[model samples]
Target: MATLKQVARWVPSHWGAGHLVLAGFLALLVLAVSPVIKLDLVVNGLFLGAIIGLGAIGLSLVYGILKFAHIGHGDFMTLGAYFALFLLSDLFPRIGLTGAGLGPFTFGYPLLLALPLAMLAMAVVAIALDLGIYRRLRRRGVNPVVLAMASLGVAIALRGVVQIFWGGGTEQYPRVSKLFYRLPMDVRIPPDNLFVGGLTVVLVVALYLFLTRSKMGKAMRATSDNPDLARVSGINTEHILWWTWAIGGALAATAGVLLAVSQAQLVPIMGWRLLIPLFAAVILGGIGNPFGALVGGLIIGVTSEISTQWLNPSYKPAMAFLVMIIMLLFRPRGLFGAKD
Candidate 1:
């Protein structure tokens, strides 16, 4: 028989017996249902999970590198979607790109192209933001709390700018008529969802590879782990900071574009409302842990969607807060976070 300490060491840090038990319970609950729940809801939940995961990744990167919670991060996502909106509006007519717009391709095709462009645009914007606001503050040696406040101000100001350009009305991407997959119960899956999900997986895997395999990625990890040590080791702190902002901004934009295509709508508050769940995902996954953030996003997305079956649809947003509070009370360091 193994001693408790030995058994503890054998288990994965984030996947102890308790987590296994919870997983088993959830599985049993799903199996016990007489008639299956709505397939649409499950599929939608998965799609939502992917979008939230993308946004959460960005938040995790920023938290890890910048050592502050960026309340304004979601705005970057909104900015990306708006960028796509403008591009689509301009390109569609000229290129005669109609109904998914990739020349006999599905809805996913246009989005596939749009997402990268949006990400690049957002990355540029992030660099600019750093240069304009954060760099100045860093030079002044401002405290992290003050920097957090500055992020909030940036959020509000960006919202104002978006409103001025796009106005307060809701707009949508052109709807694609083709369905990628159809289910047994008359449920339809759009190409956009497939595209979004595929893109999310690719990005997540790529990010993981970059973090683990690339030199810059290692430098970023070093900085996140300990800025003082990184500086002492001659790591270019400024370059790493710029990369963090750029990567975070790009991820946020990608999330925004994905959400827009999935919902087919662009609203100023889209990203703002999403911030709650994004934060919840980040915290639940473990602060400064990208993998944790990914899992957290999925959990939040599924729970929120499932809860809608029991609670009012309007209460879905509150479910994230409830989960966050519970996690904070029980596992303050989050599921994957390192314990002090």
Candidate 2:
């Protein structure tokens, strides 16, 4: 008991006030809501939140490094999904890479095989966009709004190409529905979504480690913090930009695949439709704060998902918008988004 008291005395003093109050408030809310809310809804919300956080991380990174909102980020998601679909549904069959996947998963070896290729493809595409359009604008010192508008044009063109090739219909991976399981809480868990959640956690941890431990990662942070200062310090800003887009594109592509697995189908406009929630997560977490994006995604996703208990199911997206508005009105900097 004396040792415990001594350790407690050594702890930070701020824990006695703001953090404790917030913790107490959260505890009270959880206690109040736990009894009435279904456990299944909570599980579903958390799974969805994981995917949303993954999507927002990429967007946050781009905003941090590029200093502009890419309005067409949704289409990048769509592109990744469709690319994966093509590889799994078409290329894999042609190449005879068909085989069994891990037991209990709905996806066969084809979808598994396509995952990395899809990420690579998307990263290349992101680099191309920077080379072809964004870099030119940056050279001319054009405004960010023009870059945003240019992104919209790219989005339309990309969507049109997808429609022209794959048509405007829905597509999906094969044999996916057999992976659902019922848990102790009477929650119907999709194995794919569970995998998504786990993968997202792994990715986030890996990213955090990279950012903290790797030299290039430190350079990226320095660039994001102050590009001019970083350049003056001999950090190659162009290389940092390349890495930023590559990481963002890969993450976004992986998130697209995760979402596709969860829903069991894909449409061309699916990513576009997801843009609002993604943006909400990004802004809510703070415009360029990756860790904040994860927390924001959880908050937005859970609130949106559990909202079905009272509001119409169609109002889920509206909940995110409402949350963003409230955050803007109160904490414009977001939960952990204070600029360094």
Candidate 3:
């Protein structure tokens, strides 16, 4: 009982309960119409939303810690996916892992080997970006808006660089066929989606644990809340900043890889296009609240997917912007933002 209380205090009560109820209601609705609607839509939406949630969490971290909008975040995601693509195409083949050699692996299986490599590469890139641009600006005492503009420029440059290397054409994941889980009444769920969704949940839970239970994680929280105080309290602000970028970059890369795996396509502009919606999720949840970011991400993902049923799919991204605008107008602190 004592343990449960401690856990409950760490995790938000109303939000968790509310989301569970909402998810339950959604499941019921899907079951009620299971006879009519294809199970693929529900499964696909859930899976895709999970991937979106991953990227959204990274964006939230950047916003929460750095206190600036990172418009280029999606590009970083795209870079991670492209990095994975390069690894698979160039490196994987040379190591006697060619053709059906890779067939033994399924998206359902944990990417034990590839995941860390991808995360490391993305973290390096993120730190490089900070060293090259953001750090310089901070040293010069540049305003946050200037920093935001610089990030936008960096985003565009990164996108162009990706296009130059990978070509402007869409690249597809090789050999991995979509496996479906068959159910009654012709309903099928993609195993890849299930894998991605499950991985996302695990990542989020792990992040929550790290943030609340670990020493460095608490230092990160302290830094985000009050940098001066954290610094004065003997916390190494520089170390925290490095970890923040590293974690954010790694998560962004993970999201990119999962998204590409689920969709089986990688394009340079794909991540850039996702930027707005990702930011919307971050802002909607609360600028600096990781838990809020998770809920906000889930909300954005589900809402975007469901909106396709009622409106044209082309306008789906607009939904994010609309939500952001409304939130800004009504609740500037966001749905679960702290009352600072």
Q: What is the TM-score ranking, best to worst?
A: 2, 1, 3
lDDT tens digits, residues 223-295, model 2?
8888899999999899998888888888888888888888888899988887888889998888778987887
Candidate number with the higher TM-score (1 or 2): 2
List of clashing residue pairs for candidate 2: none
Alpha carbon lDDT of residue 32, candidate 2? Answer: 37
TM-score of predicted model 3?
Answer: 0.86
- Per-residue lDDT of candidate 1, residues 1-340 (tens digit): 8765555555466585348448744873683352556656666777898899899998998897888889898898898999888777667547865446454334535555666888899999999998999889978998888888999999989888889989989997766555457777645677667777888898999999999999999999999989999999999999998888888999999999888877878999899899989999998888888888888888788778877877898887799989898777666677777777
TM-score: model 1 vs. ground truth: 0.88
Residue 15 lDDT, candidate 3, scale 0-100: 59
Q: Which has the greatest TM-score? A: 2
Full ranking by lDDT: 1, 2, 3
Please, what is the TM-score per model? Answer: 0.88, 0.90, 0.86
Q: For residue 334, give model 1's deviation from the true position in Å.
A: 0.8
Q: Give stretches of model 1 more than 4 Å off.
A: 1-39, 91-109, 184-188
Candidate 3 or 2, higher lDDT = 2
Write the number of the candidate with greater lDDT, choosing between 1 and 3: 1
- Cα lDDT tens digits, model 3, 1-340, are 5664464454454554356447645874876476655455555666666777788887887888888888889998999998877777777768855442133334322244566788899999998899889989988998888989999999999889898898999996554564567887565776666657778888888999999999999999999999899999999987887888898899999989988877778888889888877888788778877777766776666666666776898787898788788667655667777766
In model 2, what is the error at residue 81, expressed in angstroms? 0.7
